[model samples]
Target: MDNYRFILSGGGTGGHIYPAIAIANELKERFPDAEILFVGAKDRMEMEKVPQAGYKIEGLWISGVQRKLTPKNLMFPLKVISSLVRSASILNKFKPHAVIGTGGFASGPLLKVASVKGIPCLIQEQNSYAGITNKLLADKVKKICVAYEGMDKFFPKDKIVKTGNPVRSDLISLSENRDNAMQFFNLDMDKPTLLVLGGSLGARRINELIEDKLSFFKTFGLQLIWQCGKLYYEEYKKYDSEEVKVYPFINRMDFAYTATDMIISRSGAGAVSELSIVGKPVIFIPSPNVAEDHQTKNAKALVAENAAVMIAERDLDTEFEEDFTDLMLTKNRQQELSDNIKRMSLPDATKRIVDEIEKMLGKG
Candidate 1:
């Protein structure tokens, strides 16, 4: 009974992929002999990341349907059919005890096939707003684990569990990492540090805003640990200096979090979840291009509770400086935001999710 087999399917973005990995890690820790597999879209970040995490992964020939009438849209049906067939074959071979989905196009076909085959299935929805894929699979899955309340609006009331999002284990305890983090990032302990995260792929608007305000930030004697993302690294590398350390991607987020005093980031669910644990003062500039403006809704939820600050992309030009200055200059305000956000952190989220998995599999 301890030797459970599970398939974790989700990808397309780090928000979805990292949660799956965290869950997989927790499962491995609990059942050391468990056989875990990952299913993700071919050519996506998960294909690379999952392997890097020391797990086997199979890639589906799949991608999300584009909003516009493009050639890829024409191939959507074909892709879906192909993914379903492959999923069925994989399930037949693995005969997993259960399947867990995070949220992405790849998870849709795999979870559907697994559920139809009578395998117990569960899904974790990281965002406050439900994703289209999770919404479609809600009725089929046995349990829906979610980070935010009011998810009953999208899922069956009886099946929903508020377990929060699964953040990486390394991020759970950062209080002891400040000195090591500062040394690793070559940051001065005397001056305040600002961490800039634009999610996994970098935000063009956020990057532009940072580039524009470099001098203004320097005026306050603030040092920066800027993660401009891989795509924009070349364009922004010229700005890297002693006071500003520019990275294409931050591999050591634990260090990044521990070294920084404040953060300016995209309000993607994964970022929001991780930031809560880091417990730093944050100004969320949610990405507007996402589906249904989910990022804005995520940021607003925290702002409503006075857990964080938010400035929309449209209002950045006029409001960003004033907002950033106020947050930076006020110590009491920073501590208040930090305290409130930390109170919102579910540091045991990964374990709770794994507990749900154990119960579903009758292994608890």
Candidate 2:
């Protein structure tokens, strides 16, 4: 009996869930006989997403602590205690050979328990600024896999491995049939296409900026493929027309990347990784709502190296039109960003992460 169990934990958002699944899928490919269990916070998107990915999952009664006063926060301590207990029970029953966390509230408790059991654990920090959960669990975990540099300030220098964030495999190697992608999107091949993405749930500021400036997009003879995200679809769909295709979600990211000449998007770690691989000229609008303003930091790292352009969310009202128009007109600037960002890409992140996992388990 191989009896080697692997426990993968992360939730709350696609950034955390997808990476955990990517790592789990890679592990299963290498060790088909190993048992795998996913642990996520109850009622989060992961409870649904993980199962859909063909993995068994358990949900912890855990929630993030509120930064401000709220009635719901009254149960924070209780939830934490219950989650810790549940995590220990799950670890006892599963008896995992190793545990992996990709930065989420549920991962904190689950990996903490795994660490206490003397099991080998790996933490994947996807952002330029470390997430609170991963930061808290840094010392406890045996290995820290990260996507950005200068992370020694967040985790132990010895434990850090600069494995770039894992993106969907297809995204790394885009199937370069641009004509086919254009046909699929019903877009003109001659016009420069702009792809605007606000992630799975959407960004309010980005959506508003696009709606406000949509009329201006036509002036440049540019076509638009907009992912408005599910949250803002109803409000933004009214603006969609023949030249502007508005989608709430895009499952075929490879096609999306291929069909576009330029991209306007939030600077989430996952989006940044995918963009680096696609090597398109990008205008980043980092969300202000994230913890520690990590998205801005992620964008700044790229901008510092001339890899991309960033417009702070608050500055969008004043600078978006000018910045966007300048980029569209300047072919030299676009090519420069494309070339520099491609230099920062790590398309084999999934392989690197899996290799580390295998090494930690002494199976390499």
- Single out the weakest 10-residue window by summed lDDT for candidate 2: 1-10
Clashing pairs in 1: none
- Relative to the unseen true structure, what is the C-alpha lDDT of residue 254 in candidate 2, on a scale of 0 to 100? 86
**Tens digits of per-residue lDDT for model 2, 1-364:** 3457999999899999999999988888877898999999999999999999999999999999889999879999999999999999999998899999999999999999899999999999999999999999999998999998899999999999999999888877787699999988899889889999999888888888888787899889989999999998998888778789999999888888999999999999999998999999999999899889989999999999999999998888889889988998899999999999999999889889988988888877
Q: Cα RMSD to native, each candidate?
A: 1.4, 1.2
**Regions more than 4 Å wrong, model 1:** 175-177
Whole-model alpha-carbon lDDT for candidate 2: 0.92
Q: Report, for every candidate in turn, its global Cα lDDT versus the true structure.
A: 0.93, 0.92
Error of 1 at 318 (Å): 0.4
Best by TM-score: 2
Poorly placed runs, candidate 2 (over 4 Å) = 1-3
